[model samples]
Target: MATNDNVYRLQGLSCMNCAAKFEKNIRAISTVEDAQVNFGALKLTVKGDATIAQLEKAGAFDGIKVLSENEPPPENTTPFWRKRESITTIISLFFIIAGYVLYFQLEPKSPFTIGTFALAIIIGGYDLFKVGLKNLVKLDFDMKTLMTIAIIGAAIIGEWGEGAIVVFLFALSEALESFSINKARKSIRTLINIAPRKAMIKRGNSVEELNVEDIRINDIMILKPGEKAAMDGEIIKGESSLNQATITGESIPVHKTFGDEVFAGTINQEGYLEVRVTKRVEDTTLSKIIHLVEEAQAERAPSQQFVDKFAKYYTPAIMAIALLVAILPPIVVGASWTEWIYLGLAVLVVGCPCALVISTPVAIVTAIGNAARNGILIKGGIHLEETGRLNAIAFDKTGTLTEGTPEVTDIVPTEPYSEADILSLAHAIEAYSQHPLASAIIKKAKLVEGKKVNAENFQSITGKGAKAVINGKEVYIGNSVLFEEIGSLPRESKQRISSLQAEGKTVMILGTSNEVYGIIAVADQIRKSSFSIIDQLFKLGIQKTIMLTGDNKTTAVAIGNQLGLSETRADLLPEDKLTTIKSLQQKYGKVAMVGDGVNDAPALASANVGIAMGGAGTDTALETANIALMADDLEKLPYTISLSRKALHVIKQNIAFSLGLKIIALLLVIPGWLTLWLAIIADVGATLLVVLNSMRLMRAGERSSIENNV
Candidate 1:
């Protein structure tokens, strides 16, 4: 039994409705003393002796699921009808059909028509009456109150059919809204389920399977040829090609060898390896990604905040309007009471709020789905909307635009030795060292199949260089700083090193027996897609592209020029990059920062939209950024921006079309030109039209010919 303060993360939440249902259902369990769900946070907090497993079973309700029990419940509450939405929908439809049949097929004023009207009232209007009465006591005039008043006023004036239609259409629209929200939240649930439940651990040349939580750091884990690594670790032996699509969204497999890092939840495609766990279950990359995603979902965007504020006032104000329509129109025009009451009912049906409530969510869901299909995962609707409006983009140079790994591209020798000879001797000394630049030289030398010359009395100097006896001769492999400490640099070698440095290459000098032999220049390669992505951004209406990098100015400018960027800042640490992003935002109004490494976390969080490159397995990037690009391919950036813009455009069209139609209908209602059937058609027809329009976002790839263009 855990203490009263214990908290657990709950998974399998499909929507706010599911969260609410789980919370309500869990309260019925005896050991569950109390449970509160923070739907906004996607967590459930429980204070009781109930174990996680017990709480999970107890919290399961119809259409509701409980995930891990270690965290508090989410804050979002369930909708009223989710538990029995299907039943309510069926009942509402039946009443609508019966009412229409009885009114049209039977004689006017028939007993069947009256009975049908009564059934409609009970089926559709009962919930509205109960909600209105409850809210009326709290002085909270909700949408239900507006609806109840309109229906009752119609019944009072002998317009029972009109009242029935209003409630029926409203009920149907609410059900649809609930369903759409559930669909929007399904992606999060799917992502949470990807974490592995168990791990294969190697113990004393034997293997045993255990729960993921029971595995510890530094444990030797054996990953078979086709198994997913269950935790983050380094390959201690063997080699494999891993399909990292689950993490990076890249369809291609990445080759991994000794000393390379492997993440849990990524499938190993070929070969087998023994890995030394570098991270525990809780700290694994997959866990961090899950944790970060949950947090990002809870964060409200500025536009969503506006919607929340509008909902608070919009419901009450509409109720007052319905009352005015019901009472004042009859008094002003000397119209029959029933006619004015029917006009009030029209207003209630028009103000169902289906359009307003779903406007943002529909666009959000469509945008997220579209983005995901194109290898980008936008954490929330807010990010999609905000990113679409960005005026400028800031990028981290290394890893984002250029491959971070340095490679030896050019080697120049002085008087006594050729390039191959210099490389061979240098590789002999560097093979014993683990420095990045040293590794690059050694890798290149190995490509040439150079002889491995053993060194005697090898000594490494921290941050300076290395000295060793190679072939009974003293060999020094390091920078000019190390040589300056011993003797003056040779004229030819000094000139070559200076030239390479000016060309933005890191120069490493190799010397033998007090004479400088040769120089190797290493540089990071530009990603093949970077230039094209920058060009695509221009076509997408982005006004500026800026590069922020820790690399030196020469290298940064070379890459920036290749991409035709307008601004470039080099030699920036992580904090400096963040400052640069802030300054750009202050100048340009809105800026998006994109990077692919853990160091980019702060800047990614601070930007108007933080976009992570190759984010599939990088948890910090995925969680911190508003959007994550799963593939290393940068071409998707423009596609994502286009999708978001199109989604927002669709939302605007729906809102305008729905509102315009409603206003025109209200005007006609007062003049007696619009009847009960017309009001119902207008309400349902407009809702369906908006829904179809929102669905256009799903087909944006086809509509815009994005695939063909790409």
Candidate 2:
């Protein structure tokens, strides 16, 4: 279903030059106020009151037609025989065969030959003639006008056979271009169809089927084995191994428990499950991925802009040169009129600029679509291009390089108090704070389940830590700095803290004004895949991987060394992280900052490309990152960079191959080696090659074979 609105989704737009032409013409129509055509996105947005019939003429050359966003598709009304392009192709082919048969097999100079040839010219090239005549009368010279003039010149010179063949081949090329674009559009259509149309939801106690949109947030949905999850939710009952490749691009089936998260479009493999929907249908991660991918195609890259602007004048310049070729040699060196005219017509045929204009948009669109199919979502062409050039990457330790959940690893208490006694006191004071360390101490309290310490006068010391009075005694619980301020921290406690920090643990001091109680150690384990991912990045030609953290130098260095990081800047506040990101950008050409917390937002904004992990579950993931890896797996980072660089390489290759052929064709004009048919073939061949080269990016997911080197 589609809707008729200002934003019109389009299909069957194969030619970038023709799309540009449609944009220009549609804007000029009196019923239109504004028109914009995104060639890569294959969409046309217009503010107008024009009917479908009038708009169709604007897109007639490119075979583009608008589709509504929320209306059911109309049934086919035209018979297959009456389809305009097919009818013209069929009728033109009949006249072409008839003309050749009458001339060679029957009568050499028969009137039947001329009649059939004229019919072929009129039938196959009628649209070209009409557009060209309109443009000529309007004093506008474009590709259609260029070809029509060449066709008339050939006929006037009595080269009817070449002219007739030229019309037939050009029509066939247009049809082929249309078909190629439709083939590419099918990929996006498949993505749209991945989610199931209907979902089963429980209303009160009854399970009923409903449209996906009608299933609201917090609804209970039952997922049968081998069925796709209808919405993003948390499993409330049962267990299953779900294949989540559609959302995260992970090949393995992930096991889900009572509270584990699941996304729409992922299949439940083993057990039936009840899920509490966490997000509405439109707010699901799958929908956002599709929207971002479409928007990315609309954002033209710098190279694409340059090519499009160059094409605006490239054709007219060629027409001027062809005029000179037609008249100059005949006047200066007594060359034959028909011979020079023939060479000029060949030049005109080669100067359409279809291949040159398509060079960037097709590659950009194909690459964006390919990346979306995988887990890595590149937000736009600019970010995609920047990511491929990144030389260094900075990672925030918590929730990124390390598992974010911290645990109390060790507890050291002085002679007077037992381990349980110290933990109860620490938990009572830590419960007043909301920091990650506080959470770890509270969790330890629950595990050891002892008498609660009733503390009075709770006060937070900002970065130092919190303090509270326990059991009518002036008590303090914090780091060494907070305890040292009251002259209560024991000198021997420094040795114990240093030893624990060196083991990559955060040490917290629990003490009071008169005596020290103990030191509690907490540590967040580094991700098992972090070292391998860092190694892969280096193999992919990344020059540096750095860690920036607010943790002690001993702990930061411990983690950095294990991961083979180039540098570790420890004990950094949020502002320090921002400075490190800016400094990295200075030393390296481009730096990508990876982080998931609010503290990392500044650094992420300052970096060349901001990469967020576990975008599927975060509110800031989409807004704060240039690229979002839906799953938290660090391995996807290397794959993302490799895919971006591959796209860049293909884009460069397509542009080079297209322009190089045009240069060689233009050079052939000097020796008059270019013929009309050869020139047309070269243009069509170049276009097809550019399209085929861009399509190579469709295998981005399978390109993980390069991960060994990376």
Compare the candidates by lDDT and give the number of the best one. Answer: 2
Total clashes in model 1, counting residue pairs 3 or more apart in sequence or in different chains: 26
Model 2 RMSD to the real structure? 5.0
Name the lDDT of candidate 1.
0.72
Backbone atom clashes (below 3 Å) for every candidate? 26, 7
Error of 2 at 268 (Å): 3.4
Candidate 2, overall lDDT?
0.81
Model 1: per-residue Cα lDDT at residue 269:
87
TM-score of 1: 0.78
In candidate 1, stretches whose alpha carbon ends up further than 4 angstroms from where it belongs are 1-105, 120-140, 196-241, 255-264, 268-283, 365-381, 414-416, 429-434, 450-503, 508-519, 573-575, 596-602, 612-658, 669-710
lDDT of 1 by residue, 1-710 (tens): 55564556655454343454567657777876788775534566777666666667755432234555443335345654555655665686687688778888987478788778868777766656776665567664445655666677677777777777777776676666555545545444555555577878987878899887788888888888878888889999999998876566566888999999898878888898889988988787666655555544555555546655776676667556766876786698776766666766676666655465555656666556545544577787678778768899998887888888899989888787787788888887888888888889888988885555777787898877898998788889888888877784777777877777776688777886478887788988788888878887888779999999898887778678878998999999999988989999999988999888488888888899888887755666666777888776676777777776676667677677666676777778656686665665676666666766776566654525643332
Give per-residue CA lDDT, model 2, range 1-710, as digits (tens).
34344766676565666777898889889978878786655667788677666778888866667776432123334554566876797788789888888878767456778778778989999977887887888887877788898888887876666677778877776665555555455455556667886889987989999888899888999999989987899999999999988777777998989999888888999999999999988888787887777778778887787887888778779898889999999999999999999888988988878777767767677767766677777888888888878999999998899999999999999989888998999988888888989999998888996787788789999878888888888777778788778887666888888788888887888887878888899899889999889988898889999999988888899999988999999999999999989988888879999988367888988899999888776768877888888787788898888877877776788778777787788789888888877777777777778778777766766766434323
